[model samples]
Target: MSTVAPRFRSHAEDILDALRENPDREALVHGHRRVTAGEFHDLVHRTAWAMQGQGIERGQTVTLLSGNLPEAIAVRYAAHLIGAQVNHLYTGLSADVQAAIVHDVETRALVVDPRLADRAAAIVEAVPVKSVLALGPSATADDLLALAATRTTDPFPGQAGPDDICAIRHTGGTTGHPKGICTTYRQVREQRKAGRAGAIETDAARQLVATTIAHAAGMLADGVLESGGTVVMLDDFDPADVLTTVERERITHLWLLPPLLYQLLDHPAMGHTDTSTLRQVLYGGCQSSPARIADAVRRLGPVLVQGYGQNEGGLISVLTPADHDPDDPERLRTAGRILDGVEVEIRDEDGSALPDGEHGEICVRSAMVMQGYWKQPELTASVLRNGWLRTGDIGFRDAEGYLTVVDRLKDMIVVVGGHVYTTELEDLLNSHPDVRQCAVFGVRDEDGMERVHAAVLLAPGATTDSDELRALVRAERGAMYVPARITFPDELPLTDVGKPDKKELRRRATTPTT
Candidate 1:
């Protein structure tokens, strides 16, 4: 009788194949230890077997809360192998928010590191979590090995289809609490394809993940695994650790947000690190200032790529390496053209198509777009029309078919006679010599009209007066873009995912104006 191999139905299978093909190759580098592909696959299968031995059924949702440890990635894959939906939360989430997501997703099994076991217990109290498998300091290497010994090395029964839900990610909300954006196995698979469409795929490139692996970037890390690449993981951002890892691993591919890239370039040893192996650098959390991009290009060559998308919409547009020319006629203004399998449209209030160079809301439709909000049908209906997902961002498209994101629709500050985009003003301000980062908010002035209020954080040991900064912005943007009042701070608030907490900034801006 011919025994048919189990279908490669899950992403775990993809990892397993890669492991089997290169058992001796280093798959993950964390801390002082590195695990080969064969050894890693053994751990994954054994973990899946152990979970099955514990009566954890397939299709059950499991909440994962841990730092960017190699085991955390393994547990996620083990869940995938057993056909469980992995609910990943940011490790820095508050207890209340954690409980909310646990309850919202109905996650029964909790796989968390011992460092966060207390938080896991808090969540268990709020929701009836069936089982808790702890890893790290509280548990020993022997404990994990013992669990693997108890379960057979053979794979557990698989029970997932490509159409089944694979991952549940909670989107940061503006109104109340965050809502889960459930992604199907199909959607996640397509999003991975969209994220790596034009990029050269090579197993020789060592991927170093410096950002928190909780958001879309986390999924990108998993995509690296799917592509048969080695990953260097980090629990937190430390410039020295990043530089050391890059040099040690001869890292060839790096993906970072603009802020993190800025920190990396400013690191004391940045100039000394051997970065010749870096073949590609991708950044796309938000729009980066032109000056910052130029700095990165100068330091890391012209390999910088920018991708624009959100939790609701997956990869939408990409600024390829070819578009990194700082001296181009457009001068690094556009966000490059839309990627393959993406359709972008600029629509007016009535859903009518806007003319080129005229700003409007951006709407996108593709396989990469998310399914919908997990439970909020009303909200889902509002944002997703037919098959298109409406991104509440305002921007115009140039005649050459490049998209330029201006600002969020709700964040547009309407002044006395015209509308001003906070992001545009912030970008212009960030390009100034002394301004490291800035945010603009709408505050009421005389006559109850909304006026633009600016808050700035300066670079270390940098100095510039408000008058000079104002004059710089006025000269670059115009009088309308100048803030009515400007304030300086040592730093700005950041979200768990490391994006600027603009909501908090607006709250602070609305504070009595004292």
Candidate 2:
């Protein structure tokens, strides 16, 4: 094994340093399997050596298609050690979409889970990557685990610089094809530092990672490992299973989306589960219903922390546990104060900054912000203006500096007399007892004027009158804010990342039926 002291500059290097410091500490816990920090470090090094032997080079892209497995984690770090850009494909995405992303990134190799062998095969058929390495046994590809076992567990001599592209994360792509948000090693390290500084630290935080580690949950796992804590991974999220794991593992932190959080709240196990060990329950990815958040605060204690960010802007703001006030209902509606080291401004269409309480595009400039979209220089230039990212989100900041995101700029409905925000109406509708989930969007009427339209998912075994919902919206917002049509769908179409697909909803609204 190579014994040269590891240089600690990038986030990946820092993680290696943490592993070296706590060699015997448990780094990961998945089901009955456990890997110590030392073991994980060795695995990563071996994987990196194997990848190098396979001709993977610096600045090349390696696409990972796997769930929350130890091998997946090791491969990601190995790529980082070898200066390869890691692009994680969402497991739930269609094979066609996955192939498109792979081709777009021009991935040199694909590291896939054994379970997703068929999907990987299909993707490879479409994209034709240079190498296909499976986590375990595979009929058509080399076994990454077996290859690592035969290789020397020596850290790769190569290391990525601060400005080198470390990752290419795919955005939700709610409107169209997913865009790859390019992030560098320096930005990732800065983001990690900011997250650690802003977090409420606990000794040896036992983090329950029930979501995909490919995204923000993976970042949270890094934070846990950095703090000498154990990461308990779940292949898939089952609300009851999550509750059981929390109690069994004594989980201290959890990162979930609003929908998953809601399921956890509604789970019967939630009532019996011992979640007192939880310090922070971070949620984001979509606008959360205030009612659901308030309920979470009441049931889950004051542990709910909301993160408002995008693929382009990494965690621009966070609503801390202290900010989840039940008494201050309006404050709960805010996305929380701007994150440390992040600058946020609500700007008008003319590129001028708007005053407090005036709604406009939420612009951000931060170290955590992505370098730009990969292979889309023109699109990147359009959004990135003089170091500020034009976040297409429409929101306003209160005098106290708390941000209230209304809706996406494109999702805003302009009526003849006034304007309507989709989230504003959706939030009110979600508060209804019978409504399980809802989405609001605008469709052009006969006169070419935008009219509000809604789709709702009712609670199981529950029924609701559309007129009642309309009256509630009219009373809470105004008569003009009421939806022109309300359709009760079996379930709202969800994007690959699990957010409600408003673009699809708009298509359904406009399409003619027999």
Candidate 3:
């Protein structure tokens, strides 16, 4: 045993301790492979040893490019155990986007999932990285798993301090650079100590992870493991597959974005699939349709949970299972009560508090609030005022203490699926040869869902239609960034300051051409 003592241990060590309680319990399930608690614990230790040998020191960033693989989760724990900051790249992002993030995050070691070897290769070729490793064998990088096999699975003291940063999760789909929220090891322990992760989970209380582990799913998975619960990983979310998996695994907890939940509810399999084992159907990546959510509550029983949060604000509020009242549409529209120990205040542009019924930006103060945006002091100062995280989200709290998020102050548009930054889309659109000028904004549909909209002016001798330009965006930034409505006007509206008149463009987007 190493005698090196650290200021404190991370939640990673706590999870390892929990794994021994029932060593034979099924801890991880990925396709045909089943990992018992003992096996996973061993894998984590081996991985930590491998990374340590490679000089993965505390606070060094380890960026991962993987799907929902069990090994990917193990890598996260391994990195955490070694006290390295982990930055998980979301899979669907363009190669350049991933490279930009990896470069900005100052990654010391890049871990690739064998399945994403090609993608990793592209990033590796683009960026000058220190070391590259893969979860399994691939020509793109060194095999981390194979390296781990040669190492001993010996337990060691955690090399992290309570105040040391542990995770850096990016808030934007930013292609230009990386900006992320920083969370410390102390906050991780505080989150657990505060009982925000819910009651203790049994081995029988299985959680299904169909979403990307780079975001909320990762947090949920960690909580599940800390409580000694089993986790079933899905490489991709097919509505039918999710339904069958829920029934097959006897899953007690499932998490989804509103769009994904809608897809599952609409799927033919949902009607026949046995979902009686489900204790919670947690959903909330964006503002959801109340009517659709009400429909879900009626169909799936009173198990729907909507967690309203931000990367910077942590989980501000939670719409509990008991709060999913189908009879009260008004209640369903609300984002539920502010969570315990979390203080929320509605503030206007001048930073003065707003009345309960008035809408303003929701500011939060709590243990879950991030330390700050990683290395961006100016941006951090803009949001973090006197220990409060100014969530760019615009919402109002009723006299009853229920929040109703009606709009967002940020330029990013939040859909049922994902947030598309208008600036990022505009930047992409302006890069095209056919574009003279372009402006992007969001407009709400009749269903109260935000849709991306753009106005463009073609350069001389150019004749690109909206469809062609949309295809370019869809190809470059993925479907989420594709404009729902693209209008090729003779000239784009401009403000007096010569800036693209996005406000006017937004109005024009909502008002169709005659």
Candidate 4:
């Protein structure tokens, strides 16, 4: 393990240095707006001053609800410099989900765009949102930049330490709730070093951030910045646009999800674009079929690097470029050896370390493991028994020490590259007037992709088709959690303990679709 070094400076320090090192260097690109490192730094400071003027005190929670805009990045950095913890919500989220997150975080103000002003207004009334500020011409609370100019440029609320929580990242839970995972400034710094060190080849040059600025993808944005690399942002996932950006910006390093990779490999326009500049491609999030990985390797070159991690931790196990072999037997199967600065062990139910090639829960002890589940000490204790983060994932290590994840110990379902907690889906499905009893499980589709499937027992005299049931779910829950397949079971199988027999459902799903 690399001695956890003292690279302990707030993100603010990095941003400041970037401006000094290359003021004219392109720092961010969104749509028609291309900002230089120097200009971006000034905007961050001005935005911080503006936030302070709006009565957003240091340590206060400021919620950001916007799409991929340059202002969003500026606001986040400004808040960090002033000691305010940022809570970012995807603008694509449902109103109810947004409401839940805002309430859960107890944010005093929301920094949103004009397009989402209506959504923010509806949420602020029900929640404790004292004020709302829009990024564009929609002046509601205060103009972000104008407010900053009024204050002294003499850097108020100085530098932050590593232990200070930088952002509250939310992840879906098996308990039917989404909890915020606290990521500290120090942890973020270490995670960036780990990410770059794991990379077979990465230098302070050109980088591309194609993933949404919501979770791990967004975290990598900061990593690239800290490494003195220029970041080119994408508003959303589009293969054509991604290729253009890579070619136009001379992007060398990039991260992509499996679905996006599939599109990029299959996109007709990709052949015309100049992607020869790409040196490294970090891909992760969900399972990728061997065929997909092989296709990507053939089309995108051997620059593909796959990783396995959760929102709670950074890169856990990464299959670097060195591990990618066209002829190797284990090429497509392993998540790669345990990363440097991280320790891994497969343990049985009794917490005893299991032998090699034996399936068990994967436990990791590292600088990247989260402190604990926010405010849930009992649950935290269960997962953090000793100094390890007991990841609720079923996997085993081979003789070569390459870890392969088999299944989730918990019943969490990852469908189409996104996590869909079964409990959350069940709760939404059960809320329907027609649903008397329902159980959700993940089943494989014709394409061998995992899709959300549900077993529904309707109420007496209640009638509904698969489409109607799906529509009800869409209304009650987000689209991501809706069941793609509905089975009208006479009765759901039950365990001896009376819980829904999900294991039985999995068995039934494997039977011929007929």
Compare the candidates by lDDT and give the number of the best one: 2
Write one digit per residue (lDDT tens) for candidate 4, span 383-431: 8866788888888899987888765656667766577766456655655
Residues 122-236, model 1: lDDT tens digits: 8777777667667644432223435766676675555678777788888655435888887788787787777667563445668887877777556766766766788888778
By descending lDDT, how would the candidates be arranged?
Answer: 2, 3, 1, 4
Candidate 3 lDDT by residue in tens digits, 1-514: 9888846778988889999788898999999999999999999999999998888898899999888888888899999888889999878667998898888889999998888888888898999889899988887678999999999988856888778888888754522355778888888776555435432233346999988888777788887887889999988777889999999999999888765776687677888999899888888766566666777899989888887877777677777778888888678778888878889899998999999998788898998788998889999999898899888877789998898876556556988676675645665786676765566778889999988888876766787888899899989999988888888887655332123556667777767668
Backbone clashes, candidate 1: 0
Per-model TM against the reference: 0.92, 0.94, 0.80, 0.77
- Inter-residue clash pairs, candidate 3: none
Q: Which candidate is the best by TM-score?
A: 2
* Model 3 C-alpha lDDT versus the unseen true structure: 0.80
**Model 2 lDDT tens row, 55-148:** 9998999999998898898899899988989999988788899999999999999999999999999999988999999999999999999999
TM-score computed on alpha carbons, candidate 4? 0.77
Worst 10 residues of 4 by lDDT: 492-501
lDDT score of residue 181 within candidate 2: 94
| Clashes (candidate 2) | 0
Off by over 4 Å in 2: 1-8, 200-203, 444-449, 507-514
After the best TM-score superposition of candidate 2, give how far the Cα of residue 285 lies from its true spot, in angstroms. 1.4
Per candidate, the number of residue pairs that clash is 0, 0, 0, 2
Model 4: lDDT of residue 52: 73
